[model samples]
Target chain A: MSAPAQERPHLLRIGDLARATGKSSRAIHLYEELGLLQPATRSSGGFRLYEPGAVERMRWIDLLHGLGFSLQEMRGVLENWWSSEQGPAAMEELRVLFQRKLEETRESIRRHRDLERELMEGLAYLETCRACATPAAPVKGCVHCTQDHGMKEEPALVAGIMTSPEPGHRSGRGSFVRVEDIG
Target chain B: MSAPAQERPHLLRIGDLARATGKSSRAIHLYEELGLLQPATRSSGGFRLYEPGAVERMRWIDLLHGLGFSLQEMRGVLENWWSSEQGPAAMEELRVLFQRKLEETRESIRRHRDLERELMEGLAYLETCRACATPAAPVKGCVHCTQDHGMKEEPALVAGIMTSPEPGHRSGRGSFVRVEDIG
Candidate 1:
């Protein structure tokens, strides 16, 4: 705050930029090669030096990655940004791309949610058989172990069916795909 | 249902299996090579023939993929099932692996949820500027455009700053990493 705007050290060394942005030195180099970043000037020692804002630019790159923009897509967004017309049409182009990404992320979330549910079902079925002390063949096939017993929860699978498949066995019984495969 | 199990024609050709499970014929061959699936029998013409149960098994494979289980990890899970002991310890190993997968899926969901929010904010901001009839430069820099227009939502980015960064400019203001980088 004490230094005048013109008096400030306007550019940062590559090391300083990397440290400030929390990116590894190699990632910064990769970003440069991808044309995502540029140096304000080179140091006397022939090092890449960045303007004050490069820190912010690199951070945007980080966020864009999380937003599901690949490096190529990120480059495209930056290149056509605000376009030459700088009007509503330019805005629409960005809007459409973001919209697609939003849907993709939503689909990913849904898939993970289903996977979590499947894992939970497998775990719960295992829990129900915790006290089982019967013979392996019968214990693995205990019909009671699959029943709700009294709780109105989802039925668990027979562990024997999951670990090893008997020929002609339908392993998809109570599988999540039964629900997902439906339109 | 009326036919005896022994009397029923139990094997399906590779094409029939592909159609039944909605997977490509190539995928079934890959699954067989991975040892995740096996044929009930082969046809006299050397075509692969599978039991009806393979359909459910393939469906499970599809679901497991969504859960982020790589082919190797999934193969390990199937191989370890029931292990040699066929006891509680064998079950515990499955539990631990499923538990890890559940956590991974939960994390993926969380990331997508955050991305969805960021995209929604960017879209809403663009919608606000949709009505502007002012000069391109001024409209792009308008402070009012960034401020909340009485809605109880997060403020939008400063328009000029988001849409156009001058050469050597940093645009990281209000970014997710601004929150993420702090702690």
Candidate 2:
């Protein structure tokens, strides 16, 4: 009942393309201005039209942005590819670029994982405070807590919140003293 | 002989604190301007001085920045803590904040971990291209590779580079065709 796949006229007007890609028309125009995108043709009413493939291209651009490539850098990447004298050279350059990004991504994961653990431990330490016997104690009292939550030392994330270095003490290590020791 | 621990004058001038914390003096001043930091006192010469604990505070601020807290939000956090009528109320508010941040951090880790895998798989796919038989082949030939490097399908990251959707095809799924099918 429907037209065959090869017989379909699949051009999308700019608005349709923007909606398909979940990007604003302004963003699509910016991509066009940057030479990162192009219209496949124009409609009879003078509206720009794009191939459905433009959606995939827009998504590819977004993925590269997520991977930390600036628009200018992405433009440079395309230029580098097209201008390369041979396929192997372009492929080698891309391989190196991807390799560096992978290393950076791994390092970012490491840092976030470390913070994840810190937040978990800090939350566990705070759980004991919910049933505090001295809920009325001054907030500053937390630095030198005497209520005996039974932890040997405060988690650094929580300790950072509750303590300041004692005035007139030169020791860099002084700030990390146990909450009980401070008390 | 070294001065007795109790008798030491441990105040650090702004420049010394900046060097110790690896922050510029301007950054320390900006933190002060934002009311997120303060001087412990002023030296006789009118230079700002800080307690050694200020270093720990600066590090804490950096950690918070890493966790995506802006300076204004950090100021609000301090205000919330001090304005609380009781310690338990303050701790409860902080507990909620940390719980949300922990969730966000976990999400960030998941996204980055996904990207890490994509890059690794993309790199592995590229490895086969290193010894490409037709190093002199037009770069576009990669989209419908005929050399039989033995990949069943292109990784999305790599396919994204090689192909554009064929014009006049309405299928959203048309862009992801295998290399052999496209050829």
Candidate 3:
């Protein structure tokens, strides 16, 4: 007679774990080597066997890794979760790590936004050509037609943007490309 | 009588350009090789000669590079500035590059914000410990005080955060921090 349905064993091999989790076998092996994971059991043939939960564990590793956590840092967070330490101490250590990561993420976002502003300015300067019905090609072409038709507000504008402090602003610097710097 | 100070030339050599711009000589040479900069003149001895304006040009190149433009791309942009075909075509092309870069920057900022939220939630869970008049040491020290009285929001909260999108959302896929997988 077949085993009871609920008691049926749905074991997976190491290869299955890698394929199912969309990770490489090498990565799975590396995780095990790092002590971040352990095979659920070893078959009589000495092959590593895993439960369904192994896939989920791999995913958590990928998630934290994407968030910029290194393997060592992730190991620390994960190990603490199951460590005999269950409350205050565990939470405090994780809080420090999370806070530091949050700040780093914020700083990166700020830099991205600044780059965005600079690109926007470059785009705007190019837009000035909109007033020109039939513009020249670009490099030496436009200068011949427009010469210097009173369209240069670079130094002063740059200075203003540099000194101003918007909300959520930090001591970070500025970009906002110069008008003369682009097409 | 010798030439007046103002009448004296302000020509600089390669070493002088490096010192003036705070760039490595190799970098300055690379910029020249990339056509992003040019020596104002060349001495009879084959030394590179640069005008004071070369320093300003070097600064612009540095700024644009910092804004994420490749040396090759910057060369293309600067070259177009003085191109004989300067006009509608040049402006349109630069606009496209700038606009694409802008969108990419916006997307990065969005991702950063999402990460910020996730990190904030992790932090909030940690803060929950503050309510425990006496949090355990941290790692292996908290269970004795309160085994599971009311310390389970972390998993559920993390799950909720993973599933929700506050605003300005797009279908950029997802992160792998599922709730059922971690503590």
TM-score of 2: 0.80
Candidate 1: residue pairs that collide: A53-B170
**Runs off by more than 4 Å, candidate 2:** A1-8, A44-46, A150-152, A164-183, B1-8, B164-183
Per-residue lDDT tens digits for candidate 3, residues B48-156, read 5666666667766666665567988776666554453646676677677768777877877887787788677667766767666565454434333453434454443
Which residue window of length 10 is worst by lDDT in model 1 chain B? B173-182
Evaluate candidate 3 and give its CAPRI docking class based on DockQ.
Answer: incorrect
Residue A57: error of model 1 in Å? Answer: 2.8
Better of 2 and 3 by lDDT: 2
The model with the greatest DockQ is: 2
Residue lDDT tens for model 2, A1-183? 222122126767777777777899999877766656766655444456666777777877887887888877766776676666677767888889999999999999999999988888878888999889888886766676776666787776666565553222222322333322322
Shift in Å, residue B72, candidate 1: 0.5
Ranking by TM-score: 2, 1, 3
Candidate 3 chain B: worst-modelled 10 consecutive residues by lDDT: B164-173
Rank by DockQ (best first)? 2, 3, 1
Model 3 vs. true fold: TM: 0.59
Among the numbered candidates, top lDDT falls to: 2
